[model samples]
Target: MFRHTKATDLLNSGVPIHVGMRYMGHKSANMFMHYAQTLSKTHEAEFLRYRKITTDGREYQQDPHEMYEAIALSKRTDRVLPHGYCTLPPRQTCDKGNACLTCTKFVTDESFEPVLRQQMEATDGLIAERQEAHEARFGEPMSQENIWLKGRFQEKNALSKILHTISAVRTSDGTFTPLRGAGSPQGRQEEN
Candidate 1:
């Protein structure tokens, strides 16, 4: 990876972005974004001495302070997502919208189990809330035809499946087999 290279120094030389990456000896744009992300910080972000990859292909930044954080948080700084990490390279836009749980490029480990559980709970509560409001106003439960309610059920189901997988596969100390790169529930089920 590039060690403290200023992007402008290369840009001002009029050599294009790909040439700048070559100057840093980086094989991929993802590697070079490591520095771009760090430089965006107000304080010097600790670029740890040795970053390693797990057998499942997750990158781990071995920062002293980071050990206390979730394993999923140690990703290349720019790739960290809310419930997991995105494998899509940095500076690339995701066209999938907010469906990371069902997107092929997203992955999460045991570290996100708690957060996922809480979300499931929230989704359940919202489903109840919406049903109640619908009944009170319309004199009937929200029909399955309601797109919003349908979406909540889908979200709840996805969350439950993830939690179940985590529980079943977790090792005694709580580490889990990485949820195989996320995709449609059907694809994920087929893999496991």
Candidate 2:
């Protein structure tokens, strides 16, 4: 019991795990885990009667920004994008406009797969049309150096990559790809 308490307190206090293990005189990670592990939360979960926490089961009662607004908070809310939402703070507008797929804070899940698919197909078609038009006007095929054309290709590729990750893994109706930053401190700090 004392071993468990000491381990718990040290670990919860943000002590390094290896350091804690050395302080506790444990060598193997298995033993360290055995001493530090606690089942209190898991044990308590058996008493939960209802899984649904809300009426519509959409997660929150209302948009979080609305709650902030009700309290007269000065915080800015997340901007909604076509596929997902931007995590960029109001102070820092994205310079890579229309490149949300490659942006650090551009979070999305399997739910947006349909929109992504449609967008990808549309981009592909548009690229082809634009290429033909460019060739006709310039008497040469659109070079890779064309900024607008290059950007379109990058967007198309990013969409394809995101779609591949989405389809490769799924949880219920949504699969969060590891690339996008959803819960990063940058966005959360601004809200506070």
Candidate 3:
């Protein structure tokens, strides 16, 4: 994990992958490439920095506290799932074993759409690459990697369906209106 994190951080900070591979003492590019999975937290921070919504040519500035408050408030609800939300008891383990997107306990709102989309795109790319490798090695038939990727693809597809059903209105002030419905408990509370 440390090696992967360091490699990811180095590459994200503008170091070339070849240089990173050399620095990490990796002789095979394929071996080093496995560490290149992007961290969603880092990706989200970068996305937030550059993608602030604008109103009438003015960017809406989100206070750090406001962001923290939003996340904290959401965390208080059992409706919020590990991947999205859960209707189960807050302290109870998921009976479905964390299969969140398709589980009845899972809920999602527009606020999480960007992260879900990012994850979906990443999973799609990963599945394609794994499928290609599996085909090359085995000359057809599903491999364990392919099966895992298929499960991930299905989960992301379910999440995307949830995202599509969410209703978001972009206000003139540049903020998105909170969504309302089964997966949207975040909409019921005011951000502090």
RMSD of each: 15.6, 17.0, 14.7
Winner by TM-score: 1
Displacement of the residue 30 alpha carbon in candidate 1, Å: 29
**lDDT of candidate 3 vs native?**
0.55
Q: What is the TM-score of each candidate against the true structure?
A: 0.48, 0.48, 0.43
Off by over 4 Å in 3: 1-83, 141-150, 167-175, 179-192
lDDT for residue 167 in candidate 2, whole number 0-100: 60
The lDDT of each candidate is 0.56, 0.58, 0.55
Predicted candidate 1 versus true structure: per-residue lDDT over 141-182, tens digit per residue:
888989888777766666666666557656688544432222
Instruction: Count clashes in each candidate, considering only residues at least 3 apart in sequence or on different chains.
Output: 0, 0, 4
Candidate 2 global TM-score: 0.48
Stretches off by above 4 angstroms in model 1 are: 1-78, 172-192
How much lDDT does candidate 2 score?
0.58
